[model samples]
Target: MEIGTLQWYPGHMVKARKMVLENLKLVDVAVELLDARIPMSSRNPEIDLILANKLRAIVLNKSDLADKSQTEKWRRFFSTEQGYPCIVLESQLGKGVNNLIAAVQELAKDILEKLAAKGRKPRPVRLMMVGIPNVGKSSLINRLAGKGSTRTGDRPGVTKGKQWIRVGKGLEMLDTPGILWPKFEDPEVGFKLAVTGAIKDEIINIEQVTLKLIHILSMKFPEALKNRYKLEVLEEDPSETLKKIGVKRGCLISGGNVDTLKTAVIVLNEFRAGKIGRFTLDELS
Candidate 1:
């Protein structure tokens, strides 16, 4: 069967995209956050156009949850290959965040020096956080400010408005609504976003998403699945494998059949929470 492109654009997201453009004028650079587990998919394609001609520092957030080797490769790809300053970050743990700070500073070095040369006091560097929904933008802001300056939640669109907050001695950040592109050119992008909880589960069929996830995981990291699910052997059929997992985890219905929905939910949440293993869905090779 042939797969076609998938697109998801809520009316609010159109407004969000416009808001991002309006707010971009107030900031010197954008701290674009990407989910480390699926770096490519997490990136909103419109971000390149949205942040054009401005300095950008890429923050691969949730680094602790991704394969270490793949994380390093992405860092190099962004910093060396793409020539953008990039840093790995674990917003939940405060790991590799100092480097993000350094990278931002490096991005604004010339502008700072120019301000100093003009006989004016260097002002706080205004930064904007831009990313697709549920990519940890709020947590990163909180981690930087050392306080809950913005609304932090586990779901997409938690930040429905834009506001400025002081984050450091010479840093201010603009938190805007998380914006997504109007259409996903590749179908896998939608699946990847769905798998990571960026897209609302209510809008997608969880069973199908979970099936795709299982298919990918079973092919790439079957050993991790084996250990996590306690399966002696994996079957070629991903549906069969998931049923075995459902039975092991006791997601059974009244008829003693595997409760696939309940089992799928568990698999997705655990994978997002990094219980299965450190994985990189967007591997370089």
Candidate 2:
């Protein structure tokens, strides 16, 4: 949010790319799980190009946190532009989940039919769920499996290795470690990820990120901030808005001083978990 320029080079990225390429032949389709709030930023360009020619389906995860109309626009955009079947799903709530499975089946229909024609029992469609860190891949897998089948947490990089999770009779998912791009070519991309909590806050300055989010919301989504916090929209300064939030939210010290840092954390946590409201960081326009 605060013009995030930090870059993370997890050793896992190299391993993830190698693993994906090595297992590409085994996978029938690539089910890319993207955050509904920041679909473009949540995507890993290297992974996209690596799996380019293969059958791919885009699963817009965390749909509940994002604007419904904007999510629809993204769904249509991906379908039209990339020719990849896209499905909107709240992996946490299981919304639009059946549709995700159906999309995968539709995309892999050719391979299924081929197996059937060969007189061999049609095996399950192998799919790889890939996305940047904290995009909710594990939660989605757990939801689809109807149990705590995958390790999940609020932070990023929870899933470190690969595991094959069986969703149903005809669907199997290869759960890979959440991977972030080595370098963010666009500064806005880094900012969006930070604002959306896809990037770890410890790696970046939370106070700065929160201020950046305040500015962005002021410009594009002032109404959201006003409605959520019941604070008057003012052009005074982001620091002033942050202080007001701290005072209003009772994030004050015993000395009656507003703790701006504490207030920033609360705002960011709420926004990331969708407690603030259904908002989308990126617009189609």
Candidate 3:
């Protein structure tokens, strides 16, 4: 399947764009959350235009699921090259929650300082959290608030409306619905998003996605595939490799034929859950 021909911008994403624009005036800073595994692909291209002139910071969420060294390189690329304050975060575990908080506070300091100079009362830092679907925006908010303050799920578009939640005495955040652009510029970007669970499984061909993943793992992290699936040797063809995995894992029908669909789901779920291995699909270069 050609990923370029696939389009997933639904009506809700259009609403999400309008919602962000409407709420832009209500926030002091914008925190863009990106998947640590595919930082370049998971970023919303429209964000730069929407957040122009606003204090912006990048949070590489789900850092624990990505190669630690690659995540660091991405952080430096965004911070040093792109001029966005970047922080690596494991939102599910709250590993870098404090660093995110500190980064936001530091970015908002100038806004607060100006208010102080005018002898106006200080206000809590208002933050706008934006990202592509399933990039861990809601999870990060929950971690920052230290509770399930916002709705969260493994699938995309879980948070349909905006919600204001107080994280601390001096911090509050506006959680918006995850947004995707009308179209993807690169088909490879779509593939990356599909493999990473940012796109709904029902929207894409699961078998093709699994084969693509197998191909990538075979080339980049062959050990992960071999070790996780107990394969002594990998087949050059991903379909053949998948069948071997299905047979080993006992995904078979009455005729003893491997259920490739079931096997695909298992592999995709395990990959997203970090059971396969820590990997970074996007490279710095």
Candidate with top lDDT is 3
Q: Estimate each model's TM-score.
A: 0.89, 0.87, 0.90
What's each prediction's clash count?
Answer: 0, 1, 0
Mark the regions of model 2 whose C-alpha exceeds 4 Å error after superposition.
1-5, 10-12, 147-163, 175-183
Pull out the clashing pairs in model 1: none
Model 2 vs. true fold: TM: 0.87
- The segments of candidate 3 whose C-alpha lies over 4 angstroms from its true place after superposition are 1-5, 9-12, 147-163, 175-182
Q: In model 1, which regions exceed 4 Å deviation?
A: 1-7, 147-163, 175-178, 181-183
Superposed by TM-score, candidate 2 places the C-alpha of residue 243 at a distance from the truth, in angstroms, of: 0.5
The order by descending TM-score is 3, 1, 2
Model 3 alpha-carbon miss at residue 140, Å: 1.1
Give the winner by lDDT: 2 or 3.
3
Worst lDDT run of 10 residues, candidate 1, spans 151-160
Worst 10 residues of 2 by lDDT: 151-160
Q: After superposition, how far is residue 24 of candidate 2 from its true place, in Å?
A: 3.4
* Greater-TM-score candidate between 1 and 3: 3
Candidate 3 per-residue lDDT over residues 1-285, each given as its tens digit = 453236555776777778777777778888888999999898877777889888998999999999999999999999999999999998888888888889999999999999999999987798877888788887887777675344322322424355667776678787553354534768788889999988777778888888999999999899999999999999999999999999999999999999999999999899999999999999876
Report lDDT (Cα) of residue 175, candidate 1: 53
